[model samples]
Target: MRKHCCTPGQTTRTPSGTKRPSVTGSFPADPILPEMVSLAGGEFLMGSAEPHAYPLDGEGPVRTESVPPYAVAATTVTVAQFDLFVTATGYLTDAERFGDSLVFEAALPHDARAHPRVAETPWWAIVGGADWRHPAGPDAEVDAVRDLADHPVVHVSRTDAEAFCRWSGTALPSEAQWEFASRGGLSQQPYPWGYERDPGGEARMNIWRGEFPGAVSTPTGKTFTAPARSYPPNGFGLFNTTGNVWEWTTGVFDQRRRDHRAVIRGGSHLCHESYCRRYRTSARSGTTPDSSSGHIGFRVITAK
Candidate 1:
């Protein structure tokens, strides 16, 4: 794995002649045709300066952060691609080694009991065989999962994600890279499409529609894990960059605070405005990089 060595307290380092991977160096671009977007190097706004932006989370105090141009993957790694990595490398995801993975308890059938689940979130249950292949626990089968091959793979940890990137000759995007790509060159809009909830009354991203955790049967779209290319691509030709799943970034959760969690950007389908409105592009949440959950997976990045 290519390591980026930098001391603590420093936010970023100057671009160097150190070798970096090309956008499509490892894999052929036929299946993953990512567009190379130009993020004109300059100082742009970061964080929300509007109401309901949640001031306490350190999301704001909109600051000017300048980032050099770079290339990023168009979408999260798909099941077919991730499967290829596992087959070639004989890789074992953290969840697979741990014997259990975090699954949303509400994802269970209506007849399921709520008491036997883990305590913190009654909706989160630790199922013994909930690895990427078995996302819904032991009984859930992928054979019936529509488009299982092309859908973005979930139930992967940072370690698992980084390993896959290494095998692919790519790297995880830094948190800055993720935010910049997600913005799609638009001014700090609340949502990826814009600062509106389906502004024209059309769903731009696939997120929790009805009540959160439970009752998430999408009126039209929510069967489960939409195809990796199901939605409209962003300005950078990135798909599902805002909602389907949370993508892990290389940045720390808080380079400022004492928080021990690593940063995970772009929310998951399980997030609801009522509970977790992390679906916004600039919005961020974190968890232990070592922690693997069903909604947590990542996309890869290559050096520009």
Candidate 2:
């Protein structure tokens, strides 16, 4: 298993090599928007004090954090929603420009499994033709995205998310805002639903129930990304805030660096207790702005 399974970041060729398509001036007169959950944000304790928390990723030293009231989407941006943005803007994602992106070893087609894998993290394969539209690879399916329309759009970079925000008149949530909203009305609970991972023997969120890098599936036999609304909503009426897919945030992981990594909240279907146990409200990891993967996505936010 990868040493830092939850904080996987792949170094790719520079995105500046190819010219990006210019986005058109205006958004659609009537755009499809996600259901927004309004949060009257206040001071909330952020970070984990649990022994399982990762220290290098900065998941500890819980502190009092606050954010002004804001509205966030009830679900992560779905493939159907992202399709509308690409159709309107003609914008190419960083993955498309780079000609390849990372795919989970298990997610790749058996034939395509021979693709070059990432160093140190052998579970991640650098597959050509793998992007938001074709997460697994070109040969996996002809109309892969259309079939998974309701699933959270994966293989999107922070730049791609910001572009969508620009076109949709929305913004990515800050770390503070995301944490505040993710907590719902509860105080410092590991999960948005409550303390126990599964209460009453019912799975509250979609996460890996089996072994890491070897086996992965939800309780309902979901192998990959589940629908954005597959799970219950938190106290703030936000769905899948702690699992399904890691959502991008606007804040830099290390503000001191000129080229800083962006923070990603929530864990995905790949998260497991033995390895990547980041399926909680306060858990976070960082990756480059241009990094895109099959498990990474983003949601939009609006300030009140």
Task: Please estimate how well model 2 matches the true structure, expressed as its whole-model Cα lDDT.
Answer: 0.82
What does the lDDT read for residue 103 in candidate 1? 69
291: Cα error in model 1, Å: 1.6
* Cα distance off (Å), candidate 1, residue 103: 1.1
Q: Which 10-residue window in model 2 sums to the lowest lDDT?
A: 214-223
TM-scores of the candidates in the order shown: 0.83, 0.93
CA RMSD of all predictions: 8.6, 2.2
Candidate 2 has which clashing residue pairs, if any?
A: none
Backbone clash pairs in model 2 (N, Cα, C under 3 Å; residues 3+ apart or in different chains), count? 0
- Predicted candidate 2 versus true structure: per-residue lDDT over 193-257, tens digit per residue: 77888899898887888766675456534238888888778888888998889999987877786
What's the lDDT for candidate 1?
Answer: 0.67
Clashing pairs for model 1 are 105-123
Residue-wise lDDT of candidate 1 within 220-239, one digit each (tens)? 24336676776777766778
